[model samples]
Target: MLFLFFCPGSFGADTDEVFVMEGDSVSLTCLKKNQQDRIKWYYNDIRIAQMNGDPSKTCTDVQCNEGTERFRDRLKLDHLTGSLTITNIRDTDAGEYKLLITRGNSDSEKIFSVSVHDKVFVMEGDSVSLTGLKKNQQDRIKWYYNDIRIAQMNGDPSKTCTDVQCNEGTERFRDRLKLDHLTGSLTITNIRDTDAGEYKLLITRGNSDSEKIFSVSVTGVPAAEQDEVKRKTVKEGESVTLDLDVKRNPNDVMTWHFNDILIAEITEDQSQICTDFQCENGEERFRDRLELDHQTGSLTIMNTRNTDSGEYKLKINSISRRRRRSVSSEKRFDVTVTASGLSSGAVAGIVVVLLVSALTAVGVGVIYHRHRSPRKAVEEKQRASVESPNKEKEIFLQTQIEIT
Candidate 1:
């Protein structure tokens, strides 16, 4: 027999938290059962912004000389639903935010907590541990790599696999992982270049759940002799050259891929440039612009356009005449090109405009969702609760009308 208990101050309210990539925009809504007369927002217990329904007035504390400088120009209010929109969010902007809505004779309060971290870098061949910081909660723990379950800790005492069992798990991390049952921490040993990606830990206690994310970046891979990231800024219509310092043999196959799409291939002692099995000179985008250095397998673009800025990868299959075997090597380069007349300020302005436009579009969609149907809102809420990474706690707000 199992029993579930709902604690005091936990009922009649819903708490939601969100994690976003750096520089991304986010929207936080204090969902209510009925429209309120006024909504006020607070950050870390300090009142920040307020919106009144009767006068149609919405202003931040900055407008009345009472708000902090942190949210001066980045916060906006959705008057209809009492949702808050944050733009160009940074790591420093992460913290606890509260919302207070005034109804006919009562005031309702809601809180939201946000946390942000860009990435975590670990050296290859070293070990790393991802921690979930709940001290007293004993529950089921599941760890995922790119959304695929890697390891799980079953709460059942009679179960065979209580802690870490990767043999039946994914092949990529079968023998290289360990999980701490008490702390809900996952440890990866002998980390390789392929293990550099996103990792998530989902913890479920009773009906409450929360998740933490870790973006692992493995370094110190010495397979190649070049920098992982090379920076080169060029003006529009200028020429650029990307080189692969691999010696090509007479029958070795050297291929160049642009943005993950195959562009050109060299075979027959580097004399032929073919798109596929057929021997051809150039493709639609390269035209007469590509020149190959046969000796070193270097590619030079004669006239570069703005569209040429992206990732350029090189793959070479070096055939060994003596051993009758081949060895393959891969290299990539990220290129960035700028217009000749655009200044730094102009570029920043363009980025801001694009982000603002994106936020506005998302706001319109949220408003449509709120006005369209309550059933839709409830459905979306359930979906969000199931999928939300930081949904370990649930807050239930008292509704004006009870659903029978």
Candidate 2:
């Protein structure tokens, strides 16, 4: 969490790469993003090519009858010049492609380029694969969870999606979790394991946040842990499963550190998982150690405590390329606690079942005056005031094991 690692040195630059085209072999590899023994290339401004050229020949060209006339078969350089390999592409050979550099030896132009993608398509099977990115129709499309932004239109009616999931503890299936209309989608009827997750579909046009990363692989069937605060054992009582696999995003702001100092800060813009055990912190001992299995974000720790060890984080937010905006994926869980715990024989068996039900209610009131049968002594005093042998031996077993 050193703020996404001392800031991720700018976010976009590979000679600014973005030359989507088609028609045949086109290799415009003139990369000098920041530095490289000099660079050069210009077409309409005439100059030909030269990016450390003449090492063994690597900038070739030949267009005889495709885009009108040309300078005839030319392939300059001997080593590795500015890069060029246009073989039979047309569309009048497009336009604008420059990169002239030189400041150490004085000759400059720095860098200035552009590319308008003309092809980008994909289609693949049974789950989902709808693609399209041109941007117009009012230019503003938002859909995320993988990069934070779950459907926003700017044409706000108070901006809704329940304002992006407002604290949903449980309802068994109240209206079954919605958001399928704006077409950003977040549906659920039955998809189990509490619906394994990692969904995305963010498409924004104005403020630019696009480079395609639309993923979706949910598989639900889990609930019970939004109210959290019920998975015991503190410093000595071992035993723990109380699942918890949680994730969150909004440019990332999640902090669930239990010992390194901090215990829960999932602003809930969206990112969930908690196969339930119990956890909370607006109060209480605040414990829900995280198990989020919406397809493995893995935070399972059942029986360990020096107060349950330390170091934990989830911090979010990211956008670099000099565009600046840090904090992205801050993970560092190192919890490890053990003193070989002990629960004092389960607290002396709950204090000998409350001192033998107070000596069996004073020997059933002196044997109910020696003759008994007062409705069998009031049904054994209401089963010893309701279950006490450690809550009647906790017998709840159901086995159907066939899991393949």
Candidate 3:
């Protein structure tokens, strides 16, 4: 069990509230301990663990008569400090826990409240909805991002405010926030990298109140950083490959998204490669045209079409050597697929041939007019002379007959 001591808090005189994400381990500490002390841990008044100094005396869950089987083998007890640790915590584990320490008939109690929040992941420019409100519940809802109030709604007067309106002229969320009038669910549109943070929703009903926290993480780079993205142009029916530019690690998880939709993924030391509908629940737009390079994590799109033209984002999640933590980085490519399968040089050659053909036809028409005009004039002159000779003879015969 990997213990994350950061999620737990130190022992306090008052009730200590600890917040953690699901699937994490947390330790509720009881610092004040004595060798002869008898420590017992309970969840919502039900005894779950009891230890009497010795490590062998530690008993948990079914081993104790009053304990329940829900925890099973997931609990660990510290014999010296009397601190309780729970591993692989589920959402059902969120509740109040009490610790009773009996030191020679003097009983002391400590309280620890655990709350499990959800982790939400999204890409830039996508919209995310934070929904934890009960339907038709007439409660006042307030939303806070990074501990700053950004939106709120009241049921009595049906009043609501968001962003600047909630802060009396502050900016930040601005027009991106949408509050549901019925459920008070908040939706943020056109999410940016700066929008990634903790969001808390507080629901108040008379004297009782409840809260839900969501950790939002934006994966890809923001659209405003287009200069960092590589641009590629390919003719239809051609293939284009987007290179990762870095050597692939064995533990790296590579996912490719087109227009914010998952299209391909490579995982498990490159043993698992999926594309289109296989990667997620969506339209199979790629249709077996995608290929993954096992060595470099590069993506190749074969027989590209105009529909493939869009923003392609690659996210790589790998473990960092220095920090020993999972870190992710994104690379984007703006692909443009032309409808015509003609290269630029081929199109230029076609234009040159059409221009030469047009010039040749115009020159041939000018030459034909110049050559035919003189021949047409000579033929007309010959026909006029042939008719003039016959007319002169007829005139002379008519004059002689008149004189006689």
Candidate 4:
């Protein structure tokens, strides 16, 4: 799994981005004020380690039982201070690293970013070294071929492996690959043409992942030999002719298959037995629609249907005049039958309906505007007429006060 780092800053800080060359070690600190609570470590949202709640029973580094396989032995958990130290990082290990600690009823979290650089080269039948960037710690390297796990080197939590216990790879890589247990570098010997593809190294430590991708290409692949597949598209209910162009012979044998099911066969004596069309053993699906041209061994369907769209295979056996055995050859044809689109009459009907609907909408809008304009004018005139009486009453009151 690859992760996108979301936190900011680089190195040392609580939410920092740590950049390291492909095979270096980095330490991520998780400080907690509460010493009695358990400390949990997560990488890209996956919980990788959790210490016992009691700090007295906690050790310096304890491997977790349940988590991602990439983090198996690379984590050095500090039970005393809740810090993590990762060794021998690979490029894949770059991502978000998080630490969770709870004290009393309050919880705290710390997130960091780690990036590892990866470099690779392609070669045929040559050994390649993927440096783990850390030395003497032999437990955190895993190699994968095309995303399938091929090998891994790991050791016990109490001590690093001086004599590495690396597991054998899958069947395709058996006895061909080797890993340096001390530094986490992978070397494959006796590389073959089939081994040309993607290889990845996943180094996980401090609850984070570093990855390296290697692409390999090999020369010398035999050229493929096969007849070109002929393609044809025909409208449904139309006539279609499939040409075989084989000359009839006394010892010649011919067979026809539709989608790999034998539909017709011709014996060496020029006798035909068929479940397809125009033969003695006729099938119901193709009964009256099929016709066979005996001289050229061609098949013609008068009314092609959508169900007839499929691959058609023709096999011919040419019998040598001197030898008793026959040499077989085959040709393939792909036929597609499609429905002819809507007719002109149907299109005309649809256009007529659309035009009528548009005109009706326009007429309705015009009628609404014409009726609403007069009503609006009448309401405004009535409002002006009502305000004139109030204005006259106010003037009369002022005149009476002046006279008094």
- Among these predictions, the greatest TM-score belongs to 3
- Per-residue lDDT over 163-244 for candidate 1, one digit per residue giving the tens place of the 0 to 100 score: 2354345687657776666766677776788998888777777889866666778887564533433435567777877775
Candidates 2 and 3: which is better by lDDT?
A: 3
Ranking by lDDT: 3, 1, 4, 2
Q: Please give the RMSD to the true structure for each candidate, in Å.
A: 41.8, 22.5, 12.5, 35.6
Which model, 2 or 3, shows the larger TM-score? 3
Q: After superposition, how far is residue 288 of candidate 2 from its true place, in Å?
A: 12
Off by over 4 Å in 1: 1-19, 22-39, 42-48, 51-118, 154-168, 219-404
Q: How many clashing pairs per prediction, in order?
A: 10, 39, 0, 9
**Candidate 4 residue-wise lDDT at 199:** 71
Collision pairs in model 3? none
Candidate 1 — which pairs collide? Answer: 12-396, 12-397, 13-395, 13-396, 13-397, 14-395, 14-396, 15-395, 61-67, 209-392
lDDT of the structure predicted as candidate 4 = 0.62
lDDT score, residue 211, model 4?
68
Model 4, 1-404: lDDT tens digits are 22223322332336766665545567776453355777777888877777767556443323444467674476777666667777776655678888777777767777877766443433343344444455335437677778777766556544322212333335775666665666676666545678777777688775776665555554432333122225667898788877755466656566777787666767655445454754444456666676656665566777788999998776665554432222344556788999978757789999999999999999999888776765565555556557897755665554445434
